[model samples]
Target chain A: EAGVTQSPTHLIKTRGQQATLRCSPISGHTSVYWYQQALGLGLQFLLWYDEGEERNRGNFPPRFSGRQFPNYSSELNVNALELEDSALYLCASSLVYEQYFGPGTRLTVT
Target chain B: EDQVTQSPEALRLQEGESSSLNCSYTVSGLRGLFWYRQDPGKGPEFLFTLYSAGEEKEKERLKATLTKKESFLHITAPKPEDSATYLCAVQAVFHAGKSTFGDGTTLTVKP
Candidate 1:
């Protein structure tokens, strides 16, 4: 089976702009999770989506939001992006316990 | 509130040398603990999952064990390819929807 896939392997956006990152879950997977790994920092949870519903989110601000489609694909949108938003955005897919991650999208905010 | 911490921010070892990385956690209602391997400029790859205390899992040269307060990833006769950051995360049984993760330990193995 194909693993989790993400689009735009690398992205560059200016400050105050809006950035959109996409994730397509593996076949037969229903849950998609978004995480951000800042430079020299650990992975921080962003959002969780299951069956096209927003399930849970982390302590991040409301500017970081996302949605899951019926097909189990997800899109993470960051409005008013700041320089700190430059990080590797990862997406994982899971059915019950273990989560399989994608290659990740490297976002650079200038 | 749940918290996770890892010891030895970074470690360097020689090929064939064995060592262990620690992941200490404090959370209510332990559900499961997960181990992952992450390489530079890449995403984390799933390694193993432990459900309860005293549980153990192994793959290749790596073995993961879980206890009430901590988890350990032991590398037996590691290789240079095993050099990567190892991450540990835990989720509460009541709230498996989300998880708490440690900062992770970076391991570098030299030939």
Candidate 2:
């Protein structure tokens, strides 16, 4: 079986621009999660989507939003990006308690 | 609010030396704790999951043990390949799918 897959291995965006990242969960997995791995900041939870519904979110602002699709794939959107938003965005798909992550999309905002 | 903390931001050991990393957490209701190994510029790789205290899991030279307040990742006869950041995360029963993670412990094993 294939693992989680994410699009755009690397992304470069400017301040005030919007960026969208995508994720495709593994087969038979319905729970998808998004996380921000900022340098030195650790892996911070961003959003969780289960069965096409937004489950829970972290302490991040509203600019960070995402959605899950019918097929269990997901997308993360960042509006009015800031320089501090430059970080690796990771998408993970889970089966109950066990979770697996994708290679991550490196977002660099100038 | 739930909190997770990992000790000794960094660790360096010889190929045959053994050591342990620590992860301490405080949550209203502990549902489960997870361990992940992450290489530079890569996503975290799942290692183990411990749901209750006194539970233990092992893979190769790495062993993970859980307790009420903390978890320890013990590395024995580690190789340079074991060098990477080890992350600890916890899920609170109240928070549902949200997981609180620590900054992580970066380990470096010399040949």
Candidate 3:
């Protein structure tokens, strides 16, 4: 079975612009999570979606939002992207306890 | 709040050297503790998941053990290919499916 897959691989946007990253979870997985890994800053949880519902979120600002699709795929949207938003955005899908991560999309804000 | 801390920010060892990385965590109720290996510019590869204290799992040359407050990833006779960052995360029962991850330990196995 294929692991989680992410789209765009990399994204570039100017400050104040909006960016969107997509992720497709493994088959049979229902929980999708988003994380941001900045340089020096460890992986920080952004959002969690289960069965197409927003389950939980992290301490990130309101500009960070996402939604899970019916098929378990997810999209993370960052509004008014700031230079500090330049980081690797990772997506993971879990069946129960363990989570499998995607390659992640590297977002760069200029 | 759930939190995770990994020690020895970075480690370097000989090709045949054996060492263990540590992960300490604090949570309301630990649902599970996870270990993952990540290569540069790539996604993390699942290594092991320990659900409770005293639980142990092994794969190839890597063995993972969990305690009530921490987890250990023991690498036996590690090879250069084992060089990568090891990440530790924990899921809390109160948070449902959410997980908190540590900064990770960067390991370099010299050949």
Candidate 4:
């Protein structure tokens, strides 16, 4: 079975612009999670969606939001992107605790 | 809030050397502990998952063991290819098993 897949391996956007990243979970997975990893930093939780419902969010600002589709794919949206938002945005899919991650989309805000 | 901390920010060993990495955690109620290996520019690859204290899991040359407050990843006769960042994560039962990740320990094996 294919693991999680992400789109737009790299994204470039100017500050104050918007950015969107997409993810497709492995078949039979119902939970999708979004995480951000800045250079030299740990993974920070962003959002969690289960069964098409927003289940949890991290300490990130309101500008960070996402939604899961009916088929378990997910999209992460960053509004009014800031230079600090330049990082690797990773998407993961799982049934419960053990999540399988995607290659991730590297977003660079200029 | 659930938290995780990994030690030895970085480690260097000779090929065939054996060592262990540590992952300390604090959670309301641990649902599971996970281990992953990540390359410099790629997503993490799943390694193992331990559900409770005293639980152990192994894969290839890596063995992961868990206790109430921490987990340890033991690597034996590591090869250069085994060099990569090792990450530990914990899921809290109250949080419905959502994971809290550690910054990770980067390992480098010399030829």
Scored by DockQ, the top model is: 2
**Candidate 1 on A1-110: residue-level lDDT in tens?**
89999989999999999999999999999999999999988888889899899988899999999999888999999999999999999999999978899999999999
lDDT of 1 at A80: 99
Per-prediction RMSD in angstroms? 0.8, 0.7, 0.9, 0.8
Q: What is the lDDT of residue A27 in candidate 4?
A: 97
lDDT of each model, Cα atoms only?
A: 0.93, 0.95, 0.93, 0.93
- Work out the iRMS of candidate 4: 1.1
**What is each candidate's DockQ, to 2 decimals?**
0.75, 0.86, 0.85, 0.76
Clashing pairs in 2: none
Ranking by DockQ: 2, 3, 4, 1
Q: Write down the lDDT that model 4 would get.
A: 0.93
Q: Which ten residues in a row have the lowest lDDT in candidate 1 chain B?
A: B91-100
Instruction: For residues B12-79, write the lDDT of model 2, one tens digit per residue.
Output: 99999999999999999899999999999999999999999999999999999999999999999999
Give per-residue CA lDDT, model 3, range A43-68, as digits (tens): 88899999999988899999999898
Superposed by TM-score, candidate 3 places the C-alpha of residue B44 at a distance from the truth, in angstroms, of 1.2
Residue A43 displacement in candidate 3 (angstroms): 0.6
The model with the greatest lDDT is 2
RMSD of 2: 0.7
- The lDDT, on a scale of 0 to 1, for candidate 1 is 0.93
